[model samples]
Target: MAQIDYIYSAHSAYAYLGALRLYEICKAHDVVLRHKPVLLSPVVEAAGGLPFAQRSQAHVDYFFGREIERWAEWRDLPVISCRPTFHDNPLELPNGVIITAQEAGLDADAVSFAILQAHWRDDADIADHQTLHALMEGLGLDADALLEVALSPDVQEIHRRNTEEAMEVPVFGSPTYVLDDDPFYGQDRLDMLERALSKPFAASNWSNPPVDIKAGS
Candidate 1:
């Protein structure tokens, strides 16, 4: 089975948009999907991308507003708001839960989708420990046990390692699917990713620009 490294973030709207479809695609193709939750703000910034809150209102309205609305409708998913009430909350707790759940042999994707739903559809706060526990229990996970591992030093270190790896790959944004070392960034590129799985696409022709000694002078 082909394996995909899903460099993900819990609070990402695009991640939520692509979650179910990715799952379906993986199932259809007999692929194994590994979810890696990380700190998104730094990853986006390191990739020379703008944080959503820092973007212009026009950009936000177009992408986060219209684009999200259209995709949600197309995907037949419910998104109560473009910007959730706790959208900007700290992600450590939620991200940690996902990592720990996967470590515990639970359905991390299901848990991840539930977290995304609670935030985007239900306007719930995932930053709260109590909320995370309730979500884990609702998913039939051992809430107390997972929480213990979720907050452990090793798991925390794994989260940090994930962030570093995301930066190393230089994943431009959330929901990036890397298959056979080829990165398909954005939910929009999912089709191309699927096609690539059938027959690998030709390598990109991008080459580093030559050093311009006098360019900075």
Candidate 2:
């Protein structure tokens, strides 16, 4: 079976946008999707890319203006026009919960997607402990128990390791998939991801194709 390593930030808008479709693609391809939640700020710093807050105005404007809208529309995913009300807050609670879920041997994809939906679709404050508990419970997960595990030092180290590993890679953004060492860097590159999955061992170091908004961005 092919291993699809999905390295992403838990609070990433792009990851939230592509979560469901990526899940479907993995299912169809019979690939094992390994979800690695990392800290985007650290990864970007290591990759020599500026954080979203520090990016040039042109980049930020393009991201908030056209890129998000076009991708959301193309993917048929619902997204808020402006940033979420709690976008500035830290995401440790929710991300820790995901790491805890993985430690508990649950399907990381289901838990991660649930957390993403809570933030992006439901507009829930993922940084809140109660919100995290509710999200886990809704997914039939043991909220109380998972919360205990979420605070474990071991689980925290896993998140740390994820971030460290991400920093070693050339990935500068979220929802980056590493299939057989090939990195596909965006949600819009799902078609290429599918092709890579279909030929797991094929030698290809493909990057994200430039999105043409008018021509199906």
Candidate 3:
């Protein structure tokens, strides 16, 4: 069976936007989806992208603001107009919860989507233990047992490793889908991703001019 490595963060807006459709695509294609949650900041930094705070107002407004609104409408996913109150809160807790579910034979995908929806739709703080517990319990999972393991060093280590591997993949942003080692970065690429399920794209012969050598220099 074909597998797609779903590398994303629990709080990523784009990931939330693409969540359900991604599940649909996987089901339609009979592809196995591996949910690999990570700390998004480090991965974004490693990819040479600016932190949210460091980004210019224009950059943030368009990409993080307007773009999100447009995509939410496009994807038919409801999202809070403003950023979540706890958007900058630490992500280890939520990311670990997803990993814990995966490791503990729980429904990690459902857990992942629930977290994403809560954060995006309801502005829930995923970093909060109570919020996580409620989210898990809502899924009919053993909240206490899951939270205990989710916060453990063993599960957090998996989250750490996920971030490391994403950096190695050099992921450009959240919601990267890796098929046969080729990365389709961002939810916007899902259509291409679906197409590739039937017809893989040609091998990459990608190249870029040396930075020191300017165009028309």
Cα lDDT tens digits, model 3, 1-217, are 9999999999999999998899999999999999999888889999878888998999989999999999999988899989899999998899888998998888888999999999999999999999999999999999999889887989988888999999999998999999999999999999999999999999989998666534554
State the C-alpha lDDT per candidate: 0.88, 0.82, 0.92
Candidate 1: tens digits of C-alpha lDDT, residues 1-217:
8999998888888899999999988998999989999999899889878877689999989888899898999888898855888888998889998998888778999999989888878889988889888988998888899888887898889899999999989999888999988889999888888888898998889898776657852
lDDT of 3 at 106: 82
Model 1 local distance difference test score:
0.88
Candidate 1: list runs displaced more than 4 Å. 208-217
lDDT of 2 by residue, 24-134 (tens): 999998988888888778788888787677878888878865787888888788877767778767866677888888777897888898888777767778888898888
- RMSD for all candidates, in order, please: 2.4, 6.0, 1.9
TM-score of 1: 0.93
For each candidate, give its TM-score against the true structure: 0.93, 0.88, 0.95
Candidate 1 vs candidate 2: the lDDT winner is 1
Q: List clash counts for every candidate, in order.
A: 0, 0, 0
- Candidate 1 weakest lDDT stretch, 10 residues: 208-217
> Where's the lowest-lDDT run of ten residues in candidate 3?
208-217
